[model samples]
Each structure stands twice: as C-alpha cells, then as structure tokens.
Target: MKQYTLLLAEDEPFLGKVVKESLEKKGYAVMLAPDGKQAWQLYTSFEFDMCILDVMMPYKDGFTLAAQIRQANPKIPLMFLTAKADIRDVTQGYASGGNDYLKKPFSLDELFLRVAELLKRASPENQPADEFTIGSYSFSPKRQELKDSDGTIVKLSHKESQLLVLLLQNKNLVMDRKATLLKLWGDDNFFNTRNMDVYITRLRKKLHKDPAIEIVNIRGFGYKLIC
Candidate 1:
C-alpha cells in the first residue's frame, strides 16, 4: 500500500490531534501545523499528496495560505475545515483554490470520506510542473535549486526560495512589498523588511549571470521579476 502524506493545518489543538491520529491510523503520514505560518514553512520544505486547512488560523488565514499554495502547486488537493456557516465563506474557499469545504462539528467518519474522495479524483498526470523556467535558468522551488544554462546550480534558503516563487508568480508585475512581508515573515516590521531586502539582493546576485533576469524594486510598491 502506498502511504500518502497529508499536511493538516489546524489551529485547534484537540481537533488537530484527533484528526492527525485518525489519519495516521488509516496508514497515512500526516504533518500537523499549529498555525498558518508554520504550515507554509512545512509546505515549502516538504511535498504532500493533499492539504487540510482550517479557515481562521493565526498569522495567515486558510484562504491566503491556500492561494499561496495554489500558486506554488496548482493540482494539489485542498480541503478547508471551517466553523463559519456563511455562504460567502464557502464561496471564498473555492475561490482560494479549495477543492472541498467541510463544515465544522462534523464527524471524523465524514472527514475521512471526503479526504478519500478528493485523493481519488487527483491525477498524477495533471500534477504541477516539477520545474519552472526563468530566462536562462531552470528552477525547482521544491528542491530549492536554481540552475543556469551553464549548469551552475545555486542553492536557495527557505526565505530566498519563497520570495523567489512570489516574484515569479507575479512576473512582470509588481509584487506588493507589504503583502510579501506579511506572507513570508508574518509581519511587515522594520526588521523583517530589512531582511527581505537582503534576500532580494541575494537573489539578484545569484541570477546575475543572465542579464535578462532581473528582480527590480518598484519604489514604494514592491518587487517585480522581469525575464
């Protein structure tokens, strides 16, 4: 039997533990993240067959995290668990790339059934592309590696890779500075802002071999990747 790994991001401790244990007992390997920040960290660091996110997590909500995840890997199965009964919230979940939304106060059995259904519908052939092309470079954000046409490979740190992906997603368009800071650092304070600037500089130097690939700052706005 193949063991499918699942990333479950739920801030509720008791429910998270119960769900994780239930999934593990059914022969799945589950990585439980207590908040959206740690969830994103786990996501970029590891690969998973599916994601189960709770809507109102701290640092980042499920919708924002889902958008980021969808930007990175479009085909992965995303399921949202939320207590909010509003129809708008359900619509927002789908808009954020969620494949299924389960209302809270539901049974564990139903949760298991939904998870199985989503996984069954996912196709390997339709999975996200393993590598992305950026000018003369071949990059795999999952592997944290950037390879130039000359075959020189530059390794990237977690923050560097995340920032690079964000820039690539908004290629040729301005990526909001404050939004990037909040998404990556959980805050847009002076210190994290400085840190982000440093990472941007490092990325620029790493991709300097190709003059066409430029990560430009948009003054008071954000950064843009021009390739």
Candidate 2:
C-alpha cells in the first residue's frame, strides 16, 4: 500500500484535530491547517497528495485557496468540507477545482471513503505507462516533462501532463468532450468546459515544436491528437 499525505484545512479546532488524528491513525501523513491562509502557506512549503478544505475560514476562503492550489498543481485531488447547502455553493466548489464535496456533520466513515476514492483515481499506478512518445517528442507524464527531438526539455503543469496522456491514449481518435471534462475536472459544467479549452490551447503551444504533431479541435465534439 502506498503512503499518502493529506492537507486538511478547517478553522474549527475540534473538528480539525479530530479529522487529523483520525486520518493519521489510518496511516496517512496529515497536516492540519487552522485557516485557509495557513493552508496556502503549507501548500507552498510542502507537497501533499490531496487536500481536504473547509469552505468557510479566516484570512481566506477554501474556494479561493483551491483556485490557487489548482493553478499551482492542476492534477492534485481536492475535496471541499462545507456546511453551505446552497446549490450555488456546490457549483462554486466544482468551479474552483474541487474534485469532491462533503457537507458538514458528516461521518468519519464517509470521509474515509471519499478520500480513498479520490486518491485512487489520481494514483499514478493506475496509468498505463510512465512515459509516452509523441512525434519527435518524448513525454513523461510522471515527470511532467516533454523532451524535444533536439533534447530541449519542457516542463509541464500537472493538468497539462494529464491532458497530454489522455490525448496520447486516444491519439487520432476523438476523445469525448464531456467524458474528458468529467475525468479531469470532475464536472461537465460550462466552466470546466471552457477551462479545458484553455488547457488545450496551452498544450497546442507546448507541442508546436513538432510540426508533425497536431491537436485538432473536433468542433462540437472533443479533440484528436494527430501524430
């Protein structure tokens, strides 16, 4: 079994302590933050396999923190722990890059289940291969790097690497748009759709070094990577 590290950001002292201890006992390395600001600090200072965040907190909010984290590491799994029941709040959580949402007064057993599922989905072992070859380029999704034919290495964000891997898998075939959004962003909402478009543009620029390689927009469908 692989060891996982989690970042828990909840302002409530009792809740934070209880969750931390409970997760630690489950064999995870847990780092608890009393506020969103501290959570951001911890996120920058350390690497975490996943983040469990409370929507309401002092100095900053979980949604804001989540956006920051997503920008820094787009592939990391994030879950929201919130008391807000509004449908808009739930929508906002997904828009801000949360992979899961758990309401307050929830059971520890439920939390454990969600955590396990999210980690499993994002686990590297689930990938078919650590590296993939594109036209005139070698891509290592695990390392988030793309090596050009001339040996110039380009660093990629977690999101970019994930997208590249999916494109590779469906090379020359149209990868379904809704399915891609759901798999990467955990939602098929308009916001995630637009976000995926942005990532697609980023990938195009990154892979443009190889004239033989092209990522084509399927127009009302998905994308196809041509090599």
Candidate 3:
C-alpha cells in the first residue's frame, strides 16, 4: 500500500494525538501541527495529499489557513474538523475551499468514510479535464479553480469542481439531476438532493463575478450552464 501524507492541524493536544494515531494506524503519514500558523508553515515546507484542520487555533484560524492553503494548491483535499455547527460557519468552510466539514464529537469511522470519499472523488486520474476554459474564467480541473482575467482565482471544493466540469461538458444542455447525484454522491436521497441545491447556489455565487456565466436551473429535472 502506498503511503499518503496528511497534514493534521489541531490545538487540542489529546484529540490531535488520538486522531493522528488513528490515522497512522490506517497507513497515513500524518504531520501534526499544533496551531494554524505552524500548520501553514508546515504546509509550505512539505507536500501533503490531504489536510484536516481544526476551526479554532492560535496565531491563525482554520478558515484563514484553509484559504491560504487553497491559494497555494486548490486540488489538495481539505476537511475542517470543528465544534462550530452554525450554518454560517459551514457556509464559510465551503467558501474558504473545503471539500468536507465534520463537526466535533464525530465518530472516527465517519471521518474515515468522508476522507475516503473526498480522496476518491478528487483523484487526478478520475478528473475530467486537467484544464479548460469557461466564459471569462480559466478552469483547471486539476487545481479545482476558476482563474479570471484579473488573476483572481476562485478555489472550489471537490464537489463544486466536479459539478463545474459536468456543467461545462454539457453547456446549454440539460444535465440530469439524478444522474449527477448518482455520479458524484452515489445517491439521490432527499438530504443529498437539498445539499446539491446549496452547492449549486454557491457555485453560482462563485462564478457571479463573470457576468456572462450562469448556472440556470432546468425546471424540476436538471440544470444548464448558460454562457
């Protein structure tokens, strides 16, 4: 089995140690960073395949660190592990470029599942396009971003990036909601359906800077990306 590098940032020593040891047992080489500043420093100094960050930390916060890390490498999978469950915080996590959000008091098995899902979905070999263009933004599937003319790069979560690729692949045509749900999430349940709605709204907002781009809903069936 290949060893995957993971950056684990947590201010709580006990919890961090537990999580780090648990992951290490699963064959991951985890670099534990006690604070967000140190996490950022470690991130810059070493290469990591995934990042697991705590929301609150000294010197820097998880959301801020996530943004900085996103700027450096958008495609690297990131997850926020925190006690904050406010809707605003969850929204911020996604906007700051996180692939998954797990609240504290979470089960280790659940964390493992989320991590595996994110990594499988974000694997480079499974990605659609390494790089492409959409309206005024240059889309890089590998980086999971939309770089604008002004050099503004909007980083996307794994699902958001995958959604964009599907939309771009079938621009001006209706893409099935159920098919999308199954492909990306492996299910079309009510909860996942509503979650997809939120993601669509976020993606629209992210691309709103470019007036020509739009992700238009297609009645009750699907969506069409109009450019």
Per-model TM-score, in order, reads: 0.55, 0.58, 0.64
Give me the displacement of residue 171 in model 3, in angstroms.
Answer: 17
Question: What is the lDDT for 7 in model 2?
Answer: 97
Give the candidate number with the greatest lDDT: 2
Which candidate leads in TM-score? 3
Write out the backbone clash pairs for model 2: none
> Of 1 and 2, which scores higher on TM-score?
2
lDDT tens readout by residue for model 2, 1-227: 77899999999999999999999999999999999999999999999999999999999999999999999998899999999867689879988999988888889997997799789878877655877899989999878999998999999998898888888889999998986875666557788789899999999998898899999999999999999
Candidate 1 to truth, TM: 0.55
- Model 2 worst lDDT window (10 residues): 179-188
Cα error, residue 222 of model 1, in Å, equals 50
Per-residue lDDT for 1-227 in model 1, tens only? 77899999999999999999999998899999999999999999999999999999999999999999999998898999999867678668878888877788889897887788678658664333578899999989889999999899999996798788878878999999987864555336687689899999999999999899888888999999999
Candidate 1: what lDDT? 0.88
Score each candidate by Cα lDDT. Answer: 0.88, 0.90, 0.87
lDDT of 1 at 152: 91
